[model samples]
Target chain A: MERILEQIPRFFSGPNMTLLLEAAGLTLAMTLTGCLIGFGLAFVLVYLRQTPGMWALPLRWICITYVEVFRRIPFIVVIYLVLFFIQAVTPDASLFTIAVIAICLYAVAYTADIIRGGIESVPITQVEAAQSMNLSRLQTNIRIILPQAWPVIVPPAIAFAVSFIKDTALVSQVGVFELTFRGKELNNQGYSGLLVFGTIALCYFLLSFPLSMLGQYLEKRLATPRGERRSRKIRHS
Target chain B: MQHLEVSDVRAKYGTLEVLKGISFSIKKGEIASLVGPSGSGKSTVLRALMGLTPITGGTVMIGNERMNYSSAKEVRAARDRMAIVFQQYNLFQNMTVMQNLTLAPLKIKKWGKTDVITEAHRLLGLVGLSDRANAFPDQLSGGQQQRVALARALALKPQILLLDEVTSALDPELVNEVLDAVRKLANEGMTMIIVSHEMAFVREVADKVIFMDEGHIIEVGKPADIFDNSQTNRARDFFSKILRH
Candidate 1:
């Protein structure tokens, strides 16, 4: 244990440091881009699934099938499947592009389900109230329903984001040179495996800690009954 | 032209018919109460009129305009001139009392900012919730929340206000505050259709009372007629049972 602790400083020193920093930057880039794309697609999917009428039925079928297909399978299997499918279609596609696409496809399914749950958690009476007030469907959703739903949505969404950030490490298998890939390369060059793995783990913790804390703060803030939330924020912030 | 007329309205939930051809009309500046035992379709009538329930057969005339239930857009256009306060006091839980009252007026009506704010404040004062404007629905008591719901409905300046058992969910002590607000609105000549179980309060405030049973209107008359001098056995039976407790 002490030896592991001692190697931490050495992990940040030497030629290894630059490799670590570069990998960290790539991981951040992939996570940010993938999350944005995935979240947008998931919103479309949930919206299609929630809409009424025959026109939306086929769209909803496609969305439901896509979500179930991706969600039921292993992420690594999904990554390999997408990689092969993309390469078969366009052999010249960049490795980075393939990696981002794979992560986003996997992330979209889970995020869609989480958001749908949030939407359903809002009471039916809310929509009825909006209807009676003569607010359009778009106005009702944006103003009444979404605001009520976010309290249920934000915690799960952040959890998925942190998980997806870690999942970006899986892209290393496809030659993306993200964090895990860098750690493995350093290990191959005769560096202690313990130090390399430990450093990678530390980087992940550093990246995810603040985000997790922010989610907790949000959940707590929302849990406070509405009127008091503003005053409490003022008191603390 | 009548203020509102529901003619031969028929509604159903799957195979079970809830309103099997009920007809009623109210004049402008009239406060009508629908009093009946549970499952008598009093609430269904309110829901049908508000476009919440599908009226499979019937015509609803608001002033002289026929309510267009042909499409959702048309239904919304028809509903734009009316509002309903639900039994559950469905105030948007995320909004403060002030926002609940002002949201539709500001968003749907496109009212000016100063006008909307002033109107919300006025209605809040009218409901005796002037100081609780910043309180969220959950933060306030049941009575306060229902009052906020009433003020929110009034903010739209709806031509017809539908109240669906507004006092049913409140504590006995809390019931009076909500009923009092409704009474004040009645005095001011708001055209309202209230489905209430509060027999005495209904008698006191309603200009006309309609007694319903088994999805049919058994009697429609002045409050004293139904409550005191009923002409139908069904109305007399309902009044005796409900007013006994």
Candidate 2:
């Protein structure tokens, strides 16, 4: 306990802070790329859902298979799969590039699932209303439907981003110089272990706390009153 | 020429059949009201005509062209000639009332902004929502949303309008204002097919009143015959139960 306490001053005074920033940057890059990839796939899959039982059955199975396999295999395994199998084909790929690619592939699977739920969450009548206006299927998707689904989709997306920031620390094992990697190296170089990890944690909190708060703020702001949006906001309390 | 004709139509959703062998004809400039209890296939008839629900067997001929389900392009061409208003008012909540009203004409017609905005304001004025033109759907009452819904349907300049109980979802107090707005549109000789339970509006405004049961339209007649003096037992009972109060 004394050792842990003594490390605090050493942590703030050392070079560990810069490493955490690098980790946070890699995480954001992974999450955004993953989100964009997943969102694009989800857009395509939603149209496949409009087909009849036989045509949709196989397509749905493929999507569910992709999501379930990647989600359950563990992120560590996903990185290794990209490293060993993909590296065999594309030798000399940098660790940073590989980490970003693996995290994006993993994140895309989950984000696609999230977007699928968001698309389904929109009421059927809303889509029909777009059709009633003579908008085509694609037009209806971009113009009428996506606009309504966006507010509902935002809160969860931000929540995912915050957690994803922490998850990027795992990429350090693949030899990327992220925040966690830097903290560990600093501690190994004779900095106090407790102080190093503690400072690392503070940096993480600094990175994620505002994002977490922003998610909550957005959840409150985007929430529409079912009975009386015009008269009063729906009270969360 | 008859403006619209429905001959022996069968429409289905999933495995359940709705609008089973329903047939009707509407003259130009007529307001036809379909009245039925819930789940009685009244809404399905309008959906069938709009080609939202696929027809298993039948023909919907408007003017000389058949509602051809033979190809996607054919169905799309038929859809271009009509507009729809719903009970939920299904406004684009993200857009202001003016944006909602103008989107159809601007997007579907490729009309210039100045032309569409001026026409959109004219339609909003017709529905008495000129003042709330900039408000979102969330900023308006149920009545106001339905009024904007009317203005939106009008902006497309469609020859036929399908209204699926446009007032049923509103608060009771708000229902009258929307009905009055619809009544004015009906008076202007718009070819309209209304699915509604507002018997008073039907009796006074509808050229024809149709009573549907299960999946078929059981009876249809002049407003006096269908409402005050219904000829069929299904029609008579529906009128008695819905209008009892």
Candidate 3:
């Protein structure tokens, strides 16, 4: 424990600190942009679920394919693929922007699925009630369906954001100079592994602590009415 | 000839037909009670008229304008002029009573803020729930929630109000309060198509009573006549079963 405490001072006084902050910035930028893109796309995807006939199957397939591809493939492969195919084709683009965009594209797909499931879980009667009031499909989606779904989907969405924040560590592989990259640079420059890596972990905690707390907060908030913790624990086994 | 006429309307869900060739005419300032056993398609007739359910055949004419199944917009216009109080009390649980009442009116009519609040208050008072306007549905009793739903429905000033077993979900003691509210609405000459099983309420407030069975209108007459002298065995059996239960 004393040794761990001693490591904090050595970690903070390390040379590659600015790069740690840079990495944190890149991670947040990527996650937020990706999540926002994912949120809008998810809303559209879920709303499109209500539209009838020939359009229905195709829209569902698009959403499904998005989730399927992103969920099945490793994020690192996606980054490399983007670097190879998309970046190769586009050129003159910064790697930071490309990495952020890639994360956003991938995150958007997963969030869309989470949001879609949340929307679908809402009672059909609620949708029908809104419609019976002469609320157009758009009004129903915006007012009734999405608001109800938001509370249910938020926990997972936050979890994904935190995980994605950590995933940005993976972005260092793409030469983005995120915190992990700086920590690696510092350690390679002869800073002890304990000090450099400890700083990196602390920076990550600084980024992820609030988000983790928020997820915990949400779990508590959602659980108060349900009192399902015991049941959840029982089911896990 | 009428404010609304449902002519031999048949509604189907999948291959199972719910309302088979039910006909009724609702004049302005009329209150008709529709009563039948559970799953007898009493609610389907109302739903079909609202276009919440698609009609397999026949027509619904609202004040000389034909409601077509070809486009949702056409049916939507007809639905806008009618408000339905459902059995489950489909009030927005998250919204306050005032918000629920004001939402459709403000959204559909685009009423001013003062008008929305004033009108919502007036409607809440009409249902005897003026004091509970700020409460959420979760905060209200089953009876109070139904009252709020009634107020919300009436807030739209619909030409015809559809009460699809609105009191069916209430506790026995709570049932009377909602029934009293409906009775007052009936006295005020609101054109109402009430689908219910509470025989006594139907007898007291309904100007005409319709007895449906297996999607067909087995009997249609005054509440007294249908209750006392059901012409068909199906109607008689239904009346007996529900009343006995």
Winning model by TM-score: 1
The sequence of per-residue lDDT tens digits that candidate 2 reaches over residues B144-243 is 9999998898898888998998988889999888988888888899999999888898888899988889998888899888777888888889888888
Task: Give the lowest summed-lDDT range of ten residues in model 1 chain A.
Answer: A225-234
Give lDDT tens digits, candidate 1, residues B1-245.
Answer: 68898899999999899999999999998899998889999999988888888889988888888884768876887788788999999999878898898888888898999999998999988999899988778788999999999999999999999999999999999999998899899989999999998888888889999989889998899998789889988888878877786
lDDT string, candidate 3, A115-175, tens digits:
8778887788887788789988888877778766767888888888887888778878878
The numbered model that scores best in DockQ is 1
Please identify which of the two predictions, 2 or 3, would achieve the higher TM-score against the true structure: 3
DockQ of 3: 0.44
Q: Rank the candidates by DockQ, best first.
A: 1, 2, 3
lDDT digits (tens) for residues B1-245 of candidate 3: 69988888888899998887888887889788887777889888888777889888988888978886657788788787888988888887556788899888888778788988898898788888878876767668999999898988888889999999898788999998998899888888899999987888888888888888788887889988888788898888877877775
After TM-score superposition, the amount by which residue A23's alpha carbon in candidate 1 deviates from its true location, in angstroms, is: 1.0
Off by over 4 Å in 1: A1-12, A81-94, A192-195, A198-221, A234-237
The residue pairs found clashing in candidate 1 are none
Off by over 4 Å in 2: A1-57, A187-192, A224-237, B240-245
Going through the candidates in order, the fraction of native interface contacts each one reproduces equals 0.94, 0.60, 0.57
Q: Tens-digit lDDT track for model 2 on A1-237?
A: 787677667565535455566666766666566556655665666556444466578887876777788888878888888888768988988887787677777766766666667777788887887876678888887887777787777788678767777887787787777778887888888777767777778878888899899899988877855335544532443
Docking class of 2: acceptable
Q: For residues A144-178, write the lDDT of model 1, one tens digit per residue.
A: 88898888887888778877788787788878888
Report the poorest 10 consecutive residues by lDDT, candidate 1 chain B: B68-77
